[model samples]
Target: MRFSGESGNVTSGIPFGLASALSQAGSVLVAAPVMLDGADLISATFVRSLAGSLSLLLTVVLSTERKAQIRSMPMPIARQVFSSAVIGTGLGMTLQLYAPSGGPVGVVSALTATTPLVILPLIWFFGKAHPPGLAWVGAICAVAGVALIVNAG
Candidate 1:
C-alpha cells in the first residue's frame, strides 16, 4: 500500500480503525446501562442532551475562530446548526434509545456498528444516488461479520 505522509503506513490504518471501533463500542456499552437504568427513556435523553449541549457550548465558547464565523453568519449558520441538531441530535438519540429496547445489548451494538451497510440505501433513498459494486461487497461483508461477532458472544 502506498504510504501517504499523513498516514505513515497501511498498518497505521488497522490500529486506527480498531481503536475507533473499540472506543465507539465502549462508549455505547457504557451509556446503554445508564439509559436503561433510568426511570424512563425521556429521563435518559434529558441527561444526555444536557451534557451534549453543555459540551458543545463549551467548545464553541472556547474557539475564537468559530466565534467570529458564528457572529458573521447568524441566520444561515443558525439554520444549518438547527438542521444538524434535529437530525443528528434529536433523531439519532431517539433511535439509539429504541435499539436497546428491541434487542440484547450485544446484538444492538453489533447492528449499530454495521452502519456502513445501511448507508448504501440511505444514500439512494435520500440522495437519489446508487453506490458502486465494491460498496455492495463491503456492505455484505460487514453484515456477515456483525452477525458472526454478535452471535459468537
Candidate 2:
C-alpha cells in the first residue's frame, strides 16, 4: 500500500476501501433481517435513499468547492450523474434487497460480487481503453471466489 501524503483522507487511502467494505458488509448484514422477516422492502429502500442523499447533501453543503463544482458541471455530465444515480441506486438497491429474500447471505453476496466482471465487458463494449491485465485477474479471482463460496455452502 502507498503512504498518504497529507492530501488523502477517508476517500483516498486503504482506509477508504476498508471502510467501504465494512459499510457494504453492514448493509448486507442488515438486509438479512429485512428479508428474513418479510419486512417492507420499499420502506427500507426509502430509508437508505434518504440517508444517502442527506449525507451527500451535507457533504456538498459543507464544502464550497464541491458546491461550486456541482453548480458549474456541464449539462451532459450532470445528466449522466443524475440518471445514473436514479437508475443505479433505484434498481441496484431494490434487487439487492431482494437477493437475500431467498438464500444464504454469503452465497448471495459472492454471486453479486461479480461487479468487476460486469464492468470489464462494459468497458470493452464502450470501446474505452482496455481494462488492465490486473483488472482481468481481479475479475477472474472474484468469479473464482464466488464459485468457491457457493460450492462450499
Number of the top TM-score candidate = 2
| lDDT digits (tens) for residues 1-153 of candidate 1 | 221224356565687577658865775687787767763666666666676687568867997976986789879669977897878767776677667766787888787777657868877786667677776888899899988988786
Q: TM-score for candidate 2, please give it.
A: 0.78
How high is each candidate's TM-score? 0.56, 0.78
Q: 38-126 in candidate 2: lDDT tens per residue? A: 98888887777777677669868997987988999999989988997888777777788788978888877767667547868876676
Which segments of model 1 are wrong by more than 4 Å?
A: 1-27, 113-153
Q: Residue 59 lDDT in model 1?
A: 64
How well does model 2 score by local distance difference test? 0.75
Which 10 consecutive positions of candidate 2 have the poorest summed lDDT?
A: 1-10
For candidate 1, give the lDDT of residue 8.
53
Candidate 1 TM-score, C-alpha based: 0.56
